[model samples]
Target chain A: MKFIVEDAGAYLQIKVTEARIDAAIATPFKDKLREIVVKHRKPVHLDMANVTFMDSSGLGAMIAVRKSLPDNLAIVLCAMTPNVERVFRLTRMDRVFDIRPDAIQKEANE
Target chain B: MRLKAVVPPKTQPMFHRVLDADPVVVRATLTDMRHRFARDVCDDTLGRLELVMAELMNNVAEHAPVATSDRLPVIHLCIVRHQAGLACALADDGVSLPDACMLPRSLPPAIADNLPEGGFGWFLVQNLTQALCYYRASSRNYLAFNIPFMEREDENLS
Candidate 1:
C-alpha cells in the first residue's frame, strides 16, 4: 500500500494511492498508519480520493488504526470514493470517525 | 442441478472458473472479470460485484481449511448476466463457519475505543446483494446471490 504523507499544520494528512484496499494491504496499511500517528502525535486526516474499492478487511484496518491512536488524537477520513464510502456506511464506521466530504477544503478553511 | 440453470437461458453465457484459495488469485480473477464485463454492466453494479467477490474469496483464503498437498484448496465461481442484474454462485470445499461465527443481522455498535477489527465481511455481502443464500452440502459450502444493476444510494454519506 502506497501513501503520500503530508504534515499539515493542524493535522497529518495521508493520501492512500491504491485503487483497492483489501486483506492483502490491510495489515501493512494499519502498521504504517500507526507509526505515522505515533511519530506525528497529531490528528490524522486520511485522504481516500484515490481508493476506488474497500472491503471489510479495509474497514477493519481503519478501525484498528483508530483504536491504536491516543484518545485525544482523532483520525478523520475524507474524499472517499462512492464505493469506499459505502463500505464505511454499511459497517457504520461513519459514526465512529469524523468523515469529511472534502478534506482539502476543510483543511484549508481550518 | 445443472449450474447453467442459475440464470435464464436467454441471458448471456456464464463465466466460470475454479481458482486456488489465494488472495492474489482472487484479486486477479476479479480484475479480469471487471475488464471482461466493463462494457456489459454499469460501473456501480460491477463495483458491488467486485466488493462482494473480494469479501467472499478473501474469507476463503483466510479461514478455509488448507489441503495437505503442495497445492492449496480450491473455490469454484460462476457468474451469469441475469435479467435484473448479475447472478453469482461460489462453492468451496472449506470448513464451514462455526456456530458462533454466523452472519449478523445488524451492524456492530460503532464504538471508537473498542471498535471491531473483523466481522464486517458477511455483513457487507448481505447488504450489497439480493436473495442471498448460504448452505453447506456434501462437505462444500455454497453461496449464491444476485447484484442488481442499479446504484445503491440508500446510505449516502452526504
Candidate 2:
C-alpha cells in the first residue's frame, strides 16, 4: 500500500511502490489512494511502473477510486506493466480509464 | 547385479501445492507457480494462466463459508504443462461453487455514471480459459481448465 505522491500544481503525481496489487492489499490500497485524491481536490497522474501484477480485486480498487472522484476531476493511469494491463484489457476496464505507456512529463515537455 | 541406467525427469514441468484458503497464501502460491513455469511458457500464455488462477483461488478465499466451522478451507492445486497449453486443476473443501460461475457469462454493462467495481473475476476466468469444467462431489469442489497458447504467426517459423 505504499505510494509516492508529488504535487504537480494542477494534478497529483502518484507512483505506486508495490510490486503486486492483489487481494492482500487491494482494500487498503483503495482506501489510502481515495483519501489522497479526496484531500487534494485535483486531477491525478498515477505512475504504475512498479506494479507487475494486479488481480481483479486490484482492478476493483482502481474502479472504486475512479468512482470516488467528481466527474470533472480525472485520474490518468500511466506506465502500466504488461501483467497489470492484461487484467484491464481482458475485463475491458481499459475503456473506462485513460492509460498511458509512460508517466506524465508535462513539465519536461514545456 | 547389472548397473542401473540413469533416468531423467519428465520432460514437462508440473506444480502442486496444498494450502489454506487465504489471499496471502494464494498470492504466494501464484508467484511460485509462475517462477516454476516461467522458462517453459511464453509471456502471453503465462500471463493468462496467472490471471485465471488468481481469479479462481481468490473467489474461494472471498467466499469462505463463515457460518460453518471456524477452520479455513483447504485447497489443492495442480498444474501441468502440455504441448498445446497449461492444464490446471483445483479442488477445495469450501462451499459448493455457485452454478452461475461455470456458465457462459458476459461483462457487466459499462454504464457511464455508475461503473461496475466488481463482477469481472468470473468473466475473465471464462474468457481466458478453455474446456473449463467444475463439479462438486463429497463436499469438495473441483475445477479444471486449460489456458491455450496464444497464436503466433512466427510459431511455424520457430
Candidate 3:
C-alpha cells in the first residue's frame, strides 16, 4: 500500500493510494500513519478517495492509529468512497473520528 | 381424477466460486463478483454483500490455522438470488471458532478510553444480514445468511 503525504497548512493530508485496505495492508498502513502522526505532531486528515473497500481489519487499524496518538491530537478522515465510508458507519467509527466530505474545504472553513 | 403440481424453490445461487483462501485471491474474486452483480442487484444489497464477504474472507486468511501438511486451505462462496433480496453461503476448511466465543449480536461499546483494536467482524455481519447461520460440520465451517434488497436508511452515518 502507498500513502502520499502532503502539508495541508492546518493539518497533514495523507491520501491512501490503494483500492482495498484489508488484512493484507492494515498493519503497514497503521505503522505508517503512526510514524506520520509522531513526526508531524499535528492533526492528520486521511483522504480515502481511492479506497474502494475496507474490512474489519482495516477498521481496527484506524482505531489503533487513533489510540496511538496523544490525547490532544486528532486524526480526521475525509473523502471516503461510499464503500469505505459504509464500513466506518457500520462499525460506528464515524462517531469516533472527525470525518468530513473534503479535507481542503474543511481546512479552509476552519 | 388427480392433479399434481410442482414449484421451484424461490432462492438459488446466481453466482458461486471456489477459490484459494489467500487474501489476494479473495480480494480479486470479490471485486469481480461485485461488478458482475452490480447490474442485477440493488446498490445497498451489493454493498452489504461485499462488506460481509470481505470480513469473512479476511477472518479466514488471518486466523485460519495451517493444516499439518504443506497444502494451502480453500473456501467456497455462493450468492443466491431471493424473492426479497440476496443470500450468501460460505464454507471454509479452516479452524473453527472456540466454543466459548459465540457470535456477537451487539455492537461493541464506543468507549474512548478503552477502544477496541479488533473484534467487530461478526457484529457487523449479524447486523447487515438476516437468517444468519454458522455451523461446523465434517471439518468445515459454513456460514449462510440473507440480505434484503430495500435501502437501509439506518446505515447512513449522517
User: Local distance difference test, per candidate?
Assistant: 0.81, 0.89, 0.79
Clashing pairs in 3: none
Q: Assess candidate 2 and give its TM-score to the true structure.
A: 0.93
Please give the distance, in angstroms, between residue A76's alpha carbon in candidate 1 and its true position after superposition: 1.6
Q: Rank by DockQ, highest first.
A: 2, 1, 3
lDDT (Cα, tens digit) per residue for candidate 1, span B96-151: 85643345557776664577898788778878898887889897889888987674
> Quick one: best TM-score, which candidate?
2
The candidate scoring highest on DockQ is 2
**Could you give candidate 2's per-residue lDDT for residues B12-92 as a string of tens digits?**
789999988999999999999999987778878888898898889888899999887798899999999876788899999
Docking class of 3: medium
| lDDT digits (tens) for residues A1-110 of candidate 1 | 66898888888888888887888788888898788788888888889899888888888888888887775788889898888888887787777788889846544566
**Candidate 3 per-residue C-alpha lDDT over B86-137 given as tens digits, one digit per residue, 9 for 90 to 100:** 7789999887866533455567788878898887888877778888788999
Per-residue lDDT value at A99 in model 1: 89
Candidate 1 clashes between residue pairs 3 or more apart in a chain or in different chains: none
- For each candidate, the DockQ is 0.79, 0.83, 0.76
Docking class of 1: medium
